[model samples]
Target: MADIATLFVAEGPAAFGVDSYQWVSLAMLVLIGVFIWKKVPGMITGGLDDKIAQIKQQLDEAKALRAEAETLREEYASKIAGAQKDAEKMMEGARREADAILAKAEADSEAMVARRQRMAEDKIAAAERDAVDNVRASAANAAAAASRSIIAEKHDAEADRALADKVISSI
Candidate 1:
């Protein structure tokens, strides 16, 4: 620090009555005097204030835009949530309808099977009845033939006359 202060003092004596250090100081003072005379500091302060105000306005606009973006994001999120719920509801309804259709198909299949089974049972009963009736008719024919043979083989003409006379006396 002391060395810097010595640099500002008129310590050097190189030519032309004044020291080189004093000439540098004189040039520095003239530059400061010119700056003060032209009112450059006030102009600089005014320019800085204008820049700060412009920056503040930009910040305010950015804040307003950010708020609007947040609002849009929230609205879109709500809409997406609602859409997902609607999709789920639709899926559930479709599932219920599919289940109902499956149940109906199962019931219809069962009923059809039962009806076919009943028809088969009726056919079997009819076949059994036909078989029994055929057997009864065959038995009756056989019995009549056997009786005719026995009567034809056993009875002579005289025996038949005697049987007729006996039956007439009994009547």
Candidate 2:
């Protein structure tokens, strides 16, 4: 319901004119058509899909590695615990052996001391016996010398002849 002059101006541009808004509109439409014809949207969707798949795979691998690490940690912890128990057992054995060795050494030392003491006592007893024997011998010798002197001073040959006659008669 508009006049021809107003419609022409509102329609944006004359078809034959180079300087017009219509030309820009046509170029934008053609660019959009080209993009659609080339499947650009499909290419973008495929790329995004591939990236999602890669990320999911990486996540799964990370989960698996984490599980393996946990298992390894548990294994090493158990091994360390076992090793500690073994070490403690070894230490106990060493202590027991050391105590036994010390006790044996002490016993042996005491035995040696006792043997030496017995040997010293035996030596002292032997010395005492020898001393008593020597004293007895010296006493007997002194008594014999005194008797000889007494007989030589008090008794002459007559006393000896009398003692001989008395012994002959008694026999």
Candidate 3:
């Protein structure tokens, strides 16, 4: 009874008649043998390799998408720059046209003013000529009237007949 009681409480087997540690070791060995026979390690490693390949494929796709996005961004940027340049050129052209229009309008207005001034000067000259002609005509009419009155007052019928007889005797 004492020997059986000591065996139950003993830390190790004094002489090997299988102990609890031996039973646990035997169970671990059987489990390892089953895993090997089923090729569980190979299956686990293969699944992990497939997962790694899938992740690599996703990374490659992401890289390609990023590259395409970068290309599109650059293309749009260049188009925007070109559009801005075209807008600036159009604005410059419009400014030049406006300046030309303004200059032409100013020149036309000046020409019109000069033409109107010339027309007014011609009208004034014509009026002055008409006034001088009217003054000359009035003077000529007054002189003729004075000469007729003098001739009628200074001459008579008797003096006119004596001058006629003397002219006839000499002939």
Model 2 scores a TM of: 0.68
Alpha-carbon shift of residue 38 in model 3 (angstroms): 2.8
TM-score of each: 0.57, 0.68, 0.60
Q: Which portions of model 3 miss their true places by more than 4 Å?
A: 1-17, 122-171
Error of 3 at 87 (Å): 2.1
Least accurate 10 contiguous residues by lDDT in model 2: 10-19
Give one digit per residue, the lDDT tens place, for model 2 in 57-125.
999999999999999999999999999999999999999999999999999999999999999999999
Candidate 2's displacement at residue 123, Å, is: 1.9
lDDT of 1 by residue, 32-61 (tens): 898889988888999999999999999999
Cα deviation of 150 in candidate 2 (Å)? 4.6
- 1 against 2, candidate with superior lDDT: 2
**lDDT value, residue 94 of candidate 3:** 100
Q: Is candidate 1 or candidate 3 better by TM-score?
A: 3
Ranking by lDDT: 2, 1, 3
Backbone collisions counted per model: 0, 0, 0
